[model samples]
Every structure is written in structure tokens, then in C-alpha cells.
Target: MLKVHEIFSSIQGESSHAGWPCSFLRLSGCNLACSWCDTLHAGDSFAGMSVADAAAALAALGLPLVEITGGEPLLAPETPHLVTTLADAGCTVLVETNGSLDISRLDPRAVAVMDVKCPGSGMEGRNDYANLDRLRPRDEVKFVLVDRADYDFAREIAARVWTRQMVHFSPVPGRLDAAELAAWMVADRVRARLSLQLHKYIWSPDARGV
Candidate 1:
């Protein structure tokens, strides 16, 4: 069984799949308390359901793409099974994980969008750098930058590790301006994409269920 916070259909808000209709299964609970986390409301409250039920819920949404996210989905032991279930059922699955946990165990068929916590997030120490070695070309590395220092930090990592996979640098909403971040990326000629939180623009930043 898995502890589920909410299941809803929305546009893929980030990463290479942005703007596509997708189903999101947000699981509850997290191990790290990042300073700028937007989903604090999902911390503890949840409803438990078997993997079969959760798969049914997402499949009912009729979207070909699905993302299993969380307060930190990797914290839940059943997540790998859930990912496999969804993929076997013919849905494209994405797991958005806080980079602290080991992602090597995830179903190879599901794309893993791993977030390497930047210094600005206040949880940088929690990042498992070993996860970098485990990333497949289809996976993504994300850095949510809050300032220039964070950008530099992400650039350094991308320089050393990024190859066929995409490296995304997203400015923390309201903290760093998107245009400024884009300029810095261009000036440095960094091999990374600028990701904006699309749902926040389509709906209010705090709007629920997209």
C-alpha cells in the first residue's frame, strides 16, 4: 500500500515534458525540510491505497503521461512497485524525486527527474551525489536556484556531470527573475535548460489540482 496525498490531472509543469496533459500522484511525507518547499501542506495527511488502486486512479484520468511525486516519493518503500505498475499498464511514468535518496532501484522504464538540492534550498547536504552515477540518459537533473551562488553551484555540477541527459536550472519563484537567470545561462554558455513552473502561470501559484 502507498500513502497518497492527492491524485489529479494537470499539465506537466516542468522538465522536458512541460505543457503535456499528465496525471500526478502526490504521495505524502518527506525527510528533508527545504526552506522553499511549496508542498508543506502535503507533509503528513494522506489516504492509504494499494498499488492496484492507485494505478486505477491514474489510468482513469486518461492521460498517457503520469508523474509520481511527493513530499518525497522515494521515502515510500512501495514507490518502485507503483512505478512499475503504472508503466506495465501502458502509461509513461515520471518520478520527481528529491535527490537525497537512492534512485537506482526505480523501474528503468520510468523517467527519473532528480533534483540536486542547491545551497539556496538549505538542504544541499542531503543530496546523494552517488545518484549522479546512476542517472540514465533519459533522466534529468534539476537545480532550483535562489540566487547567483546557486546558479554557479548548478553550473559547476553540470560542467562535470551532465552529458546526454538534460540539466535544468529553475529560479525559485519570486526570488530570482527568469530573464536574469536566462541571461546568466547564455553568458556562460551552460548546457542546461531554463525551466519555469508553468502551472503557476496558468493558475495562481497556490492553486490546487492545477
Candidate 2:
């Protein structure tokens, strides 16, 4: 059983899949505490459900895409089975993970959206850089920037470690301006794409369940 927080259908908020209709299974608990984390409530309060039950719930939504996000879904031992179950149910699965944990064990059919923690997030040291080598061509690496330093850090990583996979640079809402982040991306000529949380823009920033 997984510690299930909330399951809902919403627009793909961030990633190469952004703007698509997606069902989200927000699992509970996180090992790292990022300063800018917007889903803190997801970590604690949750209902325990088996992988089959979770898959059935998402299948009922009839969305073709599903994102298994967390408070760090990787923190759960059954996550791999949950992901596999979802994939077997014919959902194009996406798993958003903090890069602190090894992602190699996740089902190959699911696209991995891994985050490389920036210094401003206060969890940079926890990043498992080895995850870079494990990223598949369809996988994505993400960095949430809070300031110029964070952008520079992301740039440096992009220069050294970037592969065929898409890299995403996201501005920390309220801390870094999206326009300023775009300018940095242009001036630096980084290969990454700018990732905005489309759900936040479409609805209220604080709104949950899309």
C-alpha cells in the first residue's frame, strides 16, 4: 500500500509534458525539505492504498497521462509496483522525484522527471549525482532557481552533465521573476527549456487539486 495524499486530474503543470491533461497521485512523505516546496501538506496526511487500488482509482479518471508525484514518491518501497501497475493500466506515467534517491529502480516505461536541488533550496547536498547517468533519453532533469547563483549553478551542471534528455529551469515563485530567468537562459545560451507551473498560472497559485 502507498501513502496516498490526493489523486486528481489536472493540466500537466511542469515538465516536457506540460499543458497536457494529467492525473496526479500525490504520495505522502519526503526525506528532504526544500525551502520553496509548495506541497508540504502532501507529506503527512494520507490514506494507505494498495497499488492495485491506486491504479484502479487513476484508471477511473480516464486520463491518458498520469504523474506519480510526492512528498517524494521514491521514499516508498512499493512505488515501483505502483508505477508498473499504472503503466499496465495503459497510462503514460510520469514520476517526479527529488534527485536525492536512486531512480534506476523505477519502471523503464515511466518517464522520470528528476530534480537537481539548487543551493537556495537548502537541499543541494542531498542530490545523488549518479542519477544523471541513469537518465534515459525520454527522462528530464529539473532545477528550481531562486536567484542568480542558482541559475549559474544550473548552467554549470547543464554544461558538464547534460545529455540528450531535456533540462528544465524553473523559477522559484515569488523569489525569482520568470522574465529575469528567461533573460538569464537566453544570455547564457543554456540548452535547457524554461518550465513554468502552468496549473498555477491557470488557477490560483495556492489552489490544490488543479
Candidate 3:
């Protein structure tokens, strides 16, 4: 069984999957403490669920897409098996992982939306650079930028490993202006998708289940 924070159906908020109808399984606990964490309330366990039960719950939501997110979902030992099970069942699985852990273990059929923490997140040093070599044709890399320095950091990484189709550049809400981010991307000709938190804009930013 894995520690579960919450499970809900919502629009895919971030990444290239944005706006797609998606079910979420947010696991509890994290290995790193980001300064601008939005889901601090999810850090504690809400319940415990087995891998099969969790997969059934997501499938019952009747969405084409499903995400296994965190509080660092990779921290759960059962997650890789869960991914494999879901993929075998013909469900589209998206593993939203903080890039501090080994993502190379996930099934090839599943898409891994890996978050590469920026300097503003205060967890930059924890990034697993080796994961860059592990990215597949279908996987995505994300950078949640907070300031100009963070933008520069993201740009450099994008240049070095800009092979994928979906390099997401998202700004921290109430911190960095989206317009500024758009301008910077345009000015520098940076190749990445500008991802705004769609769920936050659709509902209250503080809302638990989208």
C-alpha cells in the first residue's frame, strides 16, 4: 500500500496535457521542501491505498488520461508497478515526478512529466542530472520559474537538452508575471511551452480538489 493524499478528477492543469480531462492520484509525503509549495496541506497522509485499488479508482473516473502525482510520487516504492499495471490495462498514465529521483524505472508506455526544480524552489541542488539522459521521446521536462535568474537557468538546460517536444516553463503564481515570462521566451527564442496553472485559474487557488 502507498500513502495517499487525495484522488480526484480534474482538468490537466500543467504541461502539454493541459485542459485534457484527467484523474489525479496525489500521493502523500515528499523528499524535498520547496519554498513555494502550494500543496502544503497534502504533505500529511489522508489515507493509505494499495496499487490495484488506486488504479481501479482512477479508471472509475472514466477519463482517457490519469496522473500519479505527489508529494514526490517517486518516493513510493509501489509507483513503478502501478504505472506498469495501468499501462497494461490500456490506460494513458502520466507520472508527475519531482526530478530528484530515478525516473528511468517507469514503464515506456507511460509519460513522465518530470519537474526540474529551479533555484527559486530552493531545491535546485537536489536535481538528478542523469535523468536528462533517461528522457524518452514521449517524456516531458518542466521548470517552475520564479524570477529572471530562474528563467536563465531553465534556458540553459533547455539548450543543453532541448530534444523533447514538451519543455514546460511555468511561473510561480503571484511571484513572476506571466507576461514577463512570455516576453523573455520570445526575446531569447527559447523553445518551451508556457504553462499556466489552469486549475488554479478555473477555481480558487486554495481549493483542494479540482
Candidate 4:
């Protein structure tokens, strides 16, 4: 059984896939609590269900792309099984996880968007730096920048990490302005793509499920 928080259809909001319509499977629980996290709702008690049941619910959505996000999806021991089951059901599974978890155990077919916490996030030290070697080109590494310090830190990591093609940077939802972050990227000549929460601009910033 998987501890699922919610299963709903929404656009991919925070990665290169942003603005694309996708179904989201938000699981419950997390191993780390970052200061700027917006999905506190996902941290509550989860409703358990079998992998088959989860896949069936996803099949009913009829969407090709499915994101397995969470308070931290990798914390769930059943995550790899869930990813495989969803893939078997013809869903393109994407798992969004904080970089602290061991993703080598996850399904290789699933696209992983691993968040590498920056200094401003307070949980920066918890990042599993070795995960960089484990990421495939299909996977993405995301940095949620809160300020200049975070931006500089992310830039430094992006330079050292061999996965430059998979790098992404996005401002914290309400902390930094998008234009400012974009300009910084240009000035620094950062090799990462800049992203914004497209769903927030489309709907209310706080709206649940697109």
C-alpha cells in the first residue's frame, strides 16, 4: 500500500515541462522540511492504496503524463513499484523528489526532477551530492532560489556537476521576482534553464489542482 495524499490532474508547474497538462499524484510524508515549502497539505496523514488501485485511478484520468510528487515521494518504500505500475498503464511517470533520497533504486524509465536545496532553504546541508552521478540525461536537477546567495550557490554547483543539460533554476514562489532571477541568469551566464510556476500565473497562486 502507498500513502497517497491526493491524486488530481494539473499542469506541470515547476520544471521544463511547465504549462503542459499533467496528472499529479501527491503522496504524503517527507524526510526533510525546507523552510519555503508550499505544499504543507501534502504532509498530512495519507490514505493507503495498492499499486494496482493507484494505477487504475490514473488510467481513469486519461492523461499521458503523470507526476509523482509529494511531501517527498522517494520516502515511500513503494515508490519504485508505483512508478513501474503507472508506466505499465501507459503513463509517462515523472517523480519530483528532494535530492536527499537515494533515487538509484527508482525506475529508470521515470523522469526524475530532483531538487537540490540551496543555502537559503535551510536544508541545504542535507542534499545528497552523490545523487548527481546517478541522474540520467532524461532526469532534471532543480534549484529553488530564494535570493542572490542561493543563486550563486546554485551557479557554483551547476558548474561542477556534470549534469548541466539537466539543470534548472526557479525562484521561490513569493520570495524573488521572476524578471530579477532571469536577469541574474543572463548576467552570470548560468547554463541552467529558468523556470516559473506556470500554474500560479494561470490560476490563483494558491489554487489547488489545475
Estimated TM-score for each candidate: 0.98, 0.98, 0.98, 0.96
Cα lDDT tens digits, model 3, 1-210, are 889899999999987889999999999899999989987887986698899898888889898798999899899999999999989988889999989999988999999999899999999999999998899889999999999999999999877677554799999999999999999999998889899999999999999888
Q: What ranges in model 1 sit over 4 Å off? A: none
What does candidate 1 score on TM?
A: 0.98
Per model, state how many residue pairs clash. 0, 0, 0, 0
Off by over 4 Å in 2: none
lDDT of 3: 0.91
Best by lDDT: 1
**Over 4 Å off in model 3, which ranges?**
none
lDDT of 2: 0.92
lDDT by candidate, in order shown: 0.93, 0.92, 0.91, 0.86
| Clash-forming residue pairs, model 1 | none
- Taking all chains together, the TM-score of candidate 3 against the true structure is 0.98
